[model samples]
Target: MNTQTLEKLREKLHDNANILGNLLVETFHYIGLFAIGAVTAWAGALTCWEMLHQGTITVDDILLLFIYLELGAMVGIYFKTNHMPVRFLIYVGITALTRYLISDVSHHHRPDMGAVYISAAILLLALAVLVVRYASSRFPSSNTPQGANATDDPERAEP
Candidate 1:
């Protein structure tokens, strides 16, 4: 009822909430890792089955397989590094889009719309990758020491 009591109660609630949020995050992290492992296993098995039965792998099929591999790799990297490499994922997405465009264009008589859309997506993803790479290089992280001449770090050498 008193202001001091209320403040203490609020702090306690805040602490409790933080603990609960952290637990939820950890739970989701584990779930994500498990799902990734399961999907990777399934994809591997499916690829093997297709290879055994069909005796031949097509370009489109290989591209789809690569998508699955990228997804699994992304998950693995997240588990190991605790961070996702956006640039690498963009590359994967570009490849997937290109592969889709190629496959669909071959089968359809007029793939103008699909081709344009896929091409635009590929271009946008490429731009994103370029931007991220440029930003990362220009403004390096703490582990990366900027040259002395760099305006951001006065202590570093210019050359």
Candidate 2:
């Protein structure tokens, strides 16, 4: 009887530990999401504030703001469908690369050949975004149940 009681106690302890582990993991996940959201918001605000202080909004500032916007959108999508869309990152990259080209042209009377490289990079990113969009529409997720999200692609799903 004593041995049976010990076994029961061990099983209960193991079950409780598993539950606690899950709770902790969930808590950390939420905390991380909140941090990403809060930081993106803060950065956007700072960018705006800097533009105000400068008394003019430069293309660079606008591009920076767009990056923040993309980050926020990525976080929001992750929260909603638990999926991270790579196309947003590609969009952000294209914008950033274009911004670099603009910066080169604006700051330098004779823009260096580097501008060509950046433009090429932007084109690549744009192509990547198109490919991702095409792939997503062409091959939809098969794992989605009725009323369930199909945003998380199998290639991107966590193990």
Q: Candidate 1's residue-wise lDDT over 117-147, tens digit each?
A: 8899999998997787677657765744446
Clashes of each: 4, 0
- lDDT of the candidates, in the order given: 0.75, 0.79
lDDT of 2: 0.79
Provide the clash count, candidate 2.
Answer: 0
The residue-by-residue lDDT of candidate 2 on 73-123, one tens digit each, is 888877876767787777778877887888889988687778878878888
lDDT of 1 at 20: 100
In the predicted model 2, the residue pairs found to clash are: none
Best-fitting candidate, measured by lDDT? Answer: 2
Global lDDT of model 1: 0.75
